[model samples]
Target: MQNYFVGSDVGTTGTKSVVIDEGGNILGFSYIEYPLIMPRPGWAEHNPEDYWNAVADTIKHSIEQARIDPRDIRGVSISALAPACILVDKNLTPLQNSHIWMDRRGIKQAQWLRDNIGEARIHASSGNPIDPYYATVKLMWERDNRPELYREAYKIQTAADYPCMKLTGRAITDYSNASLFGAGYDIVNKKWDTALLEEIGLDPDKFPDSFPCDEIIGEVTRAAAQRTGLAPGTPVMAGTVDSVAAWIAGGATENGDMSLAMGTAGVMGVVHKEARFTKNMITIAHAVNSRDTYTTVSAISACGSVLRYFRDTFGQMEMLAAQSSGEEIYDLLIRLAQQAPAGCDGLITVPYFMGERTPVWDPIARAVVFGLSLSHSKSHLLRSFMEGACFALKHNYDLIQQSGIQMNWPLVLTEGGARSPFWRQMVCDMLGVPCVFMKDAKGAPFGNALVAGVGAGVFKDYSVAKQWTEIGASHQPQQENTALYRQLFRIYRNIYEDIKKNYQDLADVTGFH
Candidate 1:
């Protein structure tokens, strides 16, 4: 038997699965795109069936392409974009479309949580704020608004856990995903704290069963086998949220080294041996479960997505020209940006197109462009938007540093936006930190593979992760750009403050629903 393993990543736009051998060599991969439905401005939903179907198609496609015998497939691991609220009945049927991590419809519930539970108490216990961005708030909001849906929900789950239950007829989630909710989980002891749950009238049993990371939760079922190409009885390893899985993919096992991911949204995370938190930072449980462990995380709601906005909305002319000329539009955008100086000649952008999350919880926030003049062009707009994300990242970075977690700038395994030299240099120049290009730039898929290795018993621990990971090039900061960005950051901070009343006014204008 060949004994290969598969790692699947449940992405917002798509689900990707990568196959690898015991020796850590890439075998083959597959992906299937899915749609994110925005029925309302603050709501983000996805059909769980879409993700399940994508998983099946992608896995079958990967296996067929890899030309590997089905018998050789050893173990399968998973990760998904999470805090996704999926209500399940006794039969594990989904109650509604998955409420994604980006949904802000739970804000009222989140505020109620903070007010009743106390922000400091919850932050200290769970390591995250009581925001709609986490699973707990979303679940409570669903319970309150859709009583019919809530009444039918026997188990509340996320995108990842729903699949797990479908596969094995058991609904369960890992500690890491539970910790991300931060309102109910006892991060220190790594359990669903009943005292906290009692406060909200939510019984601990109302949620899905929780497991430690790396624990073999169950085996694939006959129905799941039909939905997916995997063999019935294939071991399913307890998986993690996309963020923690991305950390595992980036080799962020040890404390201090940061993993900066900029896919649709942006995230900065540093894994620690134990749960720790500060007012400015949220600590989430690590997917690699054990006592004394969690990840410190800070995020910006919009990063690469803003760049896409600029390319699609503002720079459509240049994008069309490049695409028609058979040139990479992103590459063309970078070239156009080079014509502008480091600071875009006094242009700055606030990337709150999706509203601010980390370091600010204002859902009414709007995007803004500073210092725009008649002289500015498409290149300036493009560059300013790109640089603006970095500035936003820096704000989170500063807050994280203040959280008192001392991380050595030894190595930062960056993925997503860091892949582009344009994006990487902007981060380097803005933060004055040298970010090394990662060897295995694959995010959750790669991490899933490593964890699959552990599941297959190829390696006892995550130590051999180094063999699976590699680094390519390096980018150093420019001193002059550093000074310029410093001044810009001060102004960036002021921009939010100056517009705080406006954001509040917009909230007031919207009225109390």
Candidate 2:
């Protein structure tokens, strides 16, 4: 009579589900990829129905794969991409495609917010800076451009909330996701800043009620059970953003615990006991201690996706070779990258493939590859690309340190890119921090399962996460490489500073923004 829990993650590019036991072993896992709708430049969207369908399909598949009795499952939880604007009508039908986290179509609205509401006042209330990255700006874009749709909407939901609502017919958001709304969520008080919302011309009523991450918000209905293969009336917890789930999965339950989640985007989260806010970072409630603790996140718009972009755009030969040789194309690319020496022989890259998030909140900035030489081969280009991503991470880490937050050493790395030993070593050398990751970590879905276990009373508390985390290989900084990266990192920063002012000009000329 062992209890099991299910965790579902609706991500930017796909949805994943997992079933785990009390000991944190993954019993079942399923992932289904989906396309990101980019109808226009600087716009990213997803049909809300796609999220629900993927969630249902992945959950059913995971349950089937687990080969466990549905009745034995104690609870279910969800994690999803944060701050996405998904407006739905009274019957819970989506008004339109969701404007996801990567969408930069609200740049004008974000600028208006800064001009009218002032950044200081907004930051004082929301604990987030004025940026198109926040849902508040995206909602403004909807209201201004699609007035009919905005007026007809019953409630605005996050990516996570929409699926939970589908599961239980309840529209609610957790504190971690709510803080990213940025319209007027008081991070310190954990409530909507109604006055600030009013000043921003946003209806506070459009937002849903908020709860702690582990709170049992509702129970799955018979209809949802039919679709997801779960028992009817299974308890559903108010989960959290996917990054927070990844943080918990990487053993970041205690204050000062820091983890770098390198998925489609690179997100670095640091837990703090007190509510410390920095203008350069995104601050939100911690998934484990939803009330008292907070986590500051620094994100890159693209991380692993940069490599994906390279593979799709330039790795035709490797792809064909992989098809014949039965090897992963990524492994082949990394092998080629291994041929290049440290510093890529004075070549550097600034990985702002989709603008950037922290350190510099530039929405118009594009990726830059500097010092490309005639003598450089594809291997050198590939290695510089990887180093460029690490440089962007180091840029954020330096600022996090300067912001007066102490990050505990031996930083934990998790998710996709962290699976690569070469990338892990690069991060260690670039940041001068020893790093470790759990072997075969299940990422966000695993953390969602832990949240479910906590809410279902299968576990005492979130501290069990740390106890269950299995540390694998550890990487230390190579002094020679660290010294070279330090020098190159300075040049990387200078390269951006020198050319950033022209990014918007390029965007304007090209009509991309």
Write the residue-wise lDDT of candidate 1 on 238-325 in tens digits. Answer: 7777787777776777767677887767788877774458565657777664456678877788887876777788777887899799
Point out where model 1 deviates above 4 Å.
410-413, 507-513
Query: What lDDT score goes with residue 198 in model 2?
Result: 87
* Per-residue alpha-carbon lDDT of candidate 2 for residues 382-494, written as tens digits (9 for 90 to 100): 88988998999998898778878768988988878888899999999999999997675668898999999998988888887887778898999999999999998889999
Assess each prediction's global lDDT (C-alpha) against the native: 0.79, 0.89
Using lDDT, give the best candidate's number: 2
Tell me the lDDT of model 2 at 336. 88
Error of 2 at 132 (Å): 1.7
Q: What is the Cα-based TM-score of model 2? A: 0.95
Which stretches of candidate 2 lie above 4 Å from their native place? 316-327
Indicate the worst ten consecutive residues by lDDT in candidate 1: 408-417
Question: Poorest 10 consecutive residues of model 2 by lDDT?
Answer: 437-446
- Model 2 accuracy (lDDT, Cα): 0.89
